[model samples]
Target: MSHRFLAKQWSLIYVRDVLRVLVARDFKLRYKRSVLGIAWSLLVPLAQLAVMYIVFKEILRLTIPHYTSFLLAGILPWIWFQSSLITSSMTIVENRELVKQVGFPIAVLPTVTVLSQMIHFLLALPILAVFLLIDGLRPTLALVALPLVILVQFALTVSLAYIVATLQVKFRDTQYLVGICLLLFSYLTPVFWDFSGIPEPFYSIFMLNPMACLLTAYRAILLHGQLPAAKPLAALAVLSSMVLSSGCIVFLRARDRFVEEL
Candidate 1:
């Protein structure tokens, strides 16, 4: 029994080492052959910000105060969530060769994808910081809670990634479906607009969205310079845990048939 326990410990260590290597490779490959490289991460969002600012703020005349900070708080994380899900959904199918030919821990493919995109999300933070400063907002002690907010979002992303990756092994169309759904959902999220103006029933329902809660938490910290209200954070933490457990269970059960499906 002691020998078996020692072997299991080493096995976990080995898997962790492999995960690290895969994440590095995926991160590098994402920008390979691109002229702008990682700058594209910041550029894509900044370009979107420019369009939205022009349309909503200039054309429609939405009177949002400190709009850049508010919008960045939402857009950055939405990009992370959107990009992670879309990429991770295809990871299992994309690595079908590895899934079939190697004795690899297949579940780590989506984990690697999510972590690599997370690095992009983190790299884009300086842009947000610059916007905050431009708006004259200083970093506050509430910034300490930013990590907790990120952890919650990461949990939610990984959980969804696991489920999506597993489904993609059998359903090749899952990636396109994910992209379509995200495009539709973006309008529902409070990314470019203030949630305060939303009416009662819609407001309550919208707040239930994990992304809405997350972006609100981000704005609370970065835009308002205060820690988020405990209620939404607690709710998101619980939701993320439950979803993560379900995702892992689904992925593990489906993994055995992945090679055949591939």
Candidate 2:
């Protein structure tokens, strides 16, 4: 029942082509009637960033140097994860007809959702770059490590997406639960504020969250022009790998039941 055994076998392998097709089809279907096409994905995050910048910098007078830059480091990735999860949570259920009509891999559901959002994040990078320039910040060579940060983020977000999608299919309350959890977790993480705001005992605990490590490193490289300290980077590497491995296991376990449930 592992299916892991058949992963490479032609008959059992979930070919990459299948995933590509699903992603392509889903992306087109997503923006079909929209004038903006795929641009909508980046637009939402950009709009949110503008609102936050106006409120925090103008109204609250909370002047953090390179404030918008600091936020871009957090917000783009946050939107990617949040957006993907929100859309993916119902992917299987929404594609119920496809599930019964096609015998293809059910695991493709979450991957396709994540890929579409990834495309959006890529488009928004120029917008983030503009904020960095306005803050008089020039990215260092360490900026190349942006891909590594994205790699860690993808590992965590996709894994969570897979687990959530399956759970949402079985338990309708899962979406509401995820919304509440995301609300608390975003605040708990240093997305809007800095680590200075977190209390003593909580500091060590909160750092254990991968998002903490990712955002912290992103800020360091983009703003400070130095590499992320070894400890946090290592922690995220360990955490991301574990989550990715487990996500695959969890997806395989539920996929069979998904087709039946559909």
Candidate 3:
């Protein structure tokens, strides 16, 4: 019975068109009257990389090779994950009026937020490539894994977004809570540091973080010019799939209550 209901709900014939329109609307609204427009997407992460480089590389002198490339590889994906979660958490609540309207799929609200932020993430990649080139690195065969890494991250991001969005409808504090968590997780995730520097049981524990594995994969492929090891990659794939499937089930079950809760 639940399977049949899920199929009916998932079979939105116009879902693609709706998603396209929502993504377009979000893009326009995001840059509506901004002077720099899309260039801000490139500049923001680059500016962040510059500051971190000076503080960590120059001042403190954390001796990671190709530091700039390493930072970009992690920062770009972290920005995507951060922005998607924050925005998607507020999606349904922000669109309460539309959500109340019949025929609206509440799930699409968070999905739109995820897709929109993903566009920004994709736009920032070329900047990462430029930094890599400036660091005297050329693309290698391992770069082929880049798309696979992105696919897994996207699944993970959307999965978490769905769950957060659903919960945020009832608990208005979820957005603020998500922001706090992102800040803490950013420092913990080895974005600026090397995983090898971590020690003992703590190192083993940090590996359990999905973002830790994904960021390591990005650094390995883009900065080190090598593919991530099979074991960690396989683990991340499985974790992402599990999260996506479970998140979808939770979102579908809670969706009908959104309007009532709002």
Clash-forming residue pairs, model 3: none
Best by lDDT: 1
Cα lDDT for residue 89, model 1? 91
Model 1, 1-262: lDDT tens digits are: 2335434544877779978999888867868889998898889889989988889889998898898778888899999999999999989888888888645777788878888888988999999999999999999999999999999999999999999999888888999999999999998899998887878998999999899899989999998899998898998899899999999999988998997778
How displaced is residue 10 in candidate 2, in Å?
5.5
lDDT, candidate 1, equals 0.89
The worst-scoring run of ten residues by lDDT in candidate 3 lies at 1-10
Candidate 3, lDDT over the whole model: 0.88
lDDT of each: 0.89, 0.81, 0.88
RMSD of each: 2.5, 2.6, 2.1
Worst 10 residues of 2 by lDDT: 5-14
The most accurate candidate by TM-score is 1
For model 3, residues 152-190, the per-residue Cα lDDT tens digits are 899899999989998898889999999999999999898
TM-score of each: 0.94, 0.89, 0.93
Residue 71's C-alpha lDDT in candidate 3?
93
- Model 1, stretches more than 4 Å misplaced? 1-10
